[model samples]
Target: MTIMSSTSLSSGLDSVTNKSYLLHFLQLLSTCMAFFLVTRESTWSVDISNWSMFVWCFCFAVTLLTLIAELCGLQDKLHFSWDRFLITSACYCALFCLSAAIIYPIIHLQIFPDGSPRHHVIAATAFSCIASVAYAVEVVWTCARTGEPSCSLLGLLKRLEIFVACVIFAFLSNTYPSERQPALVWCVAVYCICFILGAVAMLRHRCDCDESLPYSCLGFGQSVLAVLLYTTALVLWPLYQFNGDFGGQPQRSNELSCIDELTSYLCVWDQRLVVAILTAVNLLIYVADLVILTVVSDRGSTQGLRIPSSY
Candidate 1:
C-alpha cells in the first residue's frame, strides 16, 4: 500500500509537466499577482475596487484549489469529470478577469492620485488581463483537442450565454433599471432564471449525469424560453429607457450626474443603452442555441431509431 501511494504521488508530480498543466500554472500565477498587487494597495475605499478584488481573489483561490486537486490526483476519485470542471472554471475565470481588467482601470485609475497607488492598480490590471488571456487560451486549447469528453461547441455557447447574462446584471446594478419601470423587473427575472438554468445544465453535464436526464429536450426548451424572455427585454429596455413619451431620457443629458469626465464611467443613459444591447446579444445567442439544440435533438432521435435494427 505504501509503494502504491508512492507511485501515485510520483505520477501526479510528473503530470504537472504537461502543456495543459502549464496553462493552469500560468492562471494560478497571474491571478496570484493580480490579487497581491491589488490588496497591497489602499484601494479598498473605492466601491468598484471591491468588485475587482473579489474577481482576483476568487480566481486565485479557485485556480489554486484546482491545481492542488490535480497534483493530488483527486480527479480520479471524484464522481464528476474533472476535465469538464476545469474547462468550466477556465471559461468563468476568463470572463471574470476580463471584466476586472476593463472595469478596474476605468474606475480606480480615474479616482486615484497619480503616483505609486495608480501604478499598483495598473500592474494589477495588467496581471488580470494576463490571467484572462491565459484562461481563454486554456479553453480554446481544450476545445481544439480531440477525443475529449466534454469539449463540445455547444459547451462554449452555453458559457457565452451565462457570461452575457452576468454582464447584463453588472450593467443593471449600476443603473438599477428594475427600479425605473415594472417591465424592467420582468427583464431582470428573465436574466436570473435563464442564468440559473444555464448554470444547472453546465453542472449536470460536467457531473456526467446528463445521461439520466432529457438533456437535449431540456436544452431546447430552455433555449426557446430564453429567446422569448430576452426578446421582451430587448424591446422594453430601449422603449422605456429611450422614449420621450415614456418619461425616459431620449438622449444623453448634460446633467452633471449623467457625465463623469474623469473616470469616463458609463452614464445612466449609456448604462441603459448597454443593457439594451446586451439583451439583444443574449437573445441572439439563445436563438443560435435553440437552432443547434434542435438540429442535435433531431439527429439524436434519428440515430435512436436506427440503432434497433443493427442488432
Candidate 2:
C-alpha cells in the first residue's frame, strides 16, 4: 500500500510539473509574437516619431524579459522583490499602451488623410480587441488568486474603465465621427476625475500590507509623469493650432451657432478647452496618488517597527 501511494504521489507531481512547463512555454511564445508584431509596425513609417516607436519597443522588451524570467523559474526567487513588481507593472503598462495605440488609430481613422491605407486600420482594430479581451481575462484571474481587496478592486475598476472607453470610442467613431475628438477629450477628462476619486477611496481603506505586492510609489510617480505630459500637450496644442502649423486648409466655418453667447465662444476653442480640462484632472489625480503613496509608506514603516507581546 505504501509503494502504491508513493508511486501515485510521484506521478501527480510529475504531471503538475509538466503542465507548468507547458504553460510557461506558451506564454513565452505569445510574448515573442506580440513583440514581433509591434516591431514590424514600428518600422513601416519613417515619418512616425522615434520616441513613440522607442516606447513601444521598450515595452515589448520588458514583457519579453519578464516571460524569460518566469520560464527560467527565476520568478520564484524574486517573487516578492521590487524587481518582480517593476517588471510585472512594466508589462502591464506596456500591454495597455500597445492596445491603446492599436485602437486609437483605428477609431480616429477619419482624422487621417484619405490617401492612407485602410488595411492597417482594420488589422489594428482586430488585434486591439483580441488583446484587450485577453488582458481583461488575465486581470480577472489575478484578482481571483490574490484576493487583496484594494488591489483587486483597483484592477477590476481599471479593466472596466478601459473596456468602457473602448466601447464609447467605437460608438463615437461610428455614430458621431465629426464630434468624436471633442467627445473623447471630454471622456478622458471624466475618466481622470473618476480615477482620482477611486484612488482616494482605495488608499483610505487599503488592505493590509503584503510584502509580495507592488509598492504604491511606482503608481505615484506614474501619476506625476502623466500630469506633466498632459499639461505639456495641453499647452502645446493651442500654440500649434493658433500658429496654423497643422497645415492643410483651416477648418471650415460652421454657420450653426449656440443660443447662449458663452456657449458659442467656448465652442470656437473646443480643442484647447478639452485639453485644459484634462490637464486639470490629471493634476488632481497626481496629487491624490502622491498622498496615497506617502500614507501607505508611513503605515508600512510603522507596522514594521511594532513588537509582538510574548505569552
Candidate 3:
C-alpha cells in the first residue's frame, strides 16, 4: 500500500479502537458502581468518603486490569488474575492500615493517648492476610472453574502468601507495646507494606508469569497516576473528617478482635480510602491496556516491549 493509504488505515483503526475502549470502560464502570453500592455495608456507606471508595475501587481496578490485559493478549486466560488480585489486595490492606494509623491517632489521641492498642495494629495486619487468603481462594477457584493451570498452580498462591507475610510483618512492627513506639512504628509498617506489596503487584512473578507490566498497560506513568489517585482518595480526602481529635469518631467496632488482634482494629471510623484508591488504579490500568492494544496492533509493535505483560 502507498504511504498515504497506510496512514489513513492506521488513523481509522486507531479511531475505532478508541471508541471501543471508551465503550468497554463505560460498561465496566457501570457494573462496578452497582457492585460497590450493594457490597457497601449500610453503616459504611457515605456519599464520597475514603473508607467507602478505597478498596471498592482497588478490586474493581484489578478485575478491570485483567479484562484489558486479556483484550491485549496479556493473559494466558482472560479470567481474573489471582496473583494480581492478591498483590493489589495486600497493597490496599497496607494503605487501609496506614489511613487508620493516621486518622485514628489524630481522631482519638486525647481518649487513647498511647494510640488505640496493639489490637488495632494487629487487626489491620490480619485484614491484609485475610484479603490475601481470600484472593488465593479465588485463584484456586478460578483454576478449578476453568480447569486450567492458571488456577491450578501453587506458585501464584505461594507468591501471594509471601506478600501477605510481608504485610503482616510490616503491621506487627508497630503492634509492640503501645507506649514504647506507636505512631512511628505503625507508619513505617504501612509504608513498608505499601512499597513491597505494591511493587510486587505492579510488577508480578510466579511460576512462568513475567513480573513487569505490558508496555501498553503499565509503567512509571500509570503507577504514579495510580498512587496519586489513591493518595487523593484514601489519605487526603479524610482530612476534612478531622477536627481536633474528636470529630470523626468510630461509628463501628471490631467484634472479632478475639479472632485475631489485627481484626480488632474495626471501629466506626474504620472506613478506609483503599476501595477508592484501588478502584482508580485498576481503572487506569485497564485504560492503559486498551491504549496499548490500540497503539500496538501487531507483534511487530511489541518488539518495543522490553518487559512482558503482567496480565
TM-score for each predicted model, relative to the true structure: 0.81, 0.44, 0.29
TM-score of 1: 0.81
Judging by TM-score, tell me the better candidate of 2 and 3: 2
Global CA lDDT computed for model 2: 0.42
Report the Cα lDDT for residue 97, model 1.
Answer: 95
Identify the superior model by lDDT, candidate 2 or candidate 3: 2
- Candidate closer to the true structure by lDDT (higher is better), 1 or 2: 1
Better of 1 and 2 by TM-score: 1
Question: What lDDT does candidate 2 reach at residue 128?
Answer: 43
| Tens-digit per-residue lDDT, 1-311, candidate 3 | 69999999999868755643553354345335533433442222222223323443554565477557646766555355544443444334334334333433232232222333433433333443344344434444333433333221222322333333333332332222234434323433443544455455534533322223323244435445434543443442233222225233223342223234333343223323232233344434434543544444444244443222222
| Ranked by TM-score, top first | 1, 2, 3
Please write out the lDDT profile of model 2 over residues 131-155, one tens digit for every residue.
Answer: 4344334334433433433232223
For model 2, the run of ten residues with the poorest summed lDDT: 302-311
lDDT of 1 at 157: 72
Whole-model lDDT values for every prediction? 0.74, 0.42, 0.39
Indicate which candidate wins on lDDT: 1
- Model 3's lDDT to the true fold? 0.39
- Per-residue lDDT tens digits for candidate 1, residues 32-107, read 8888887787765544356677788888888888878877978799987666677688888999999989977887
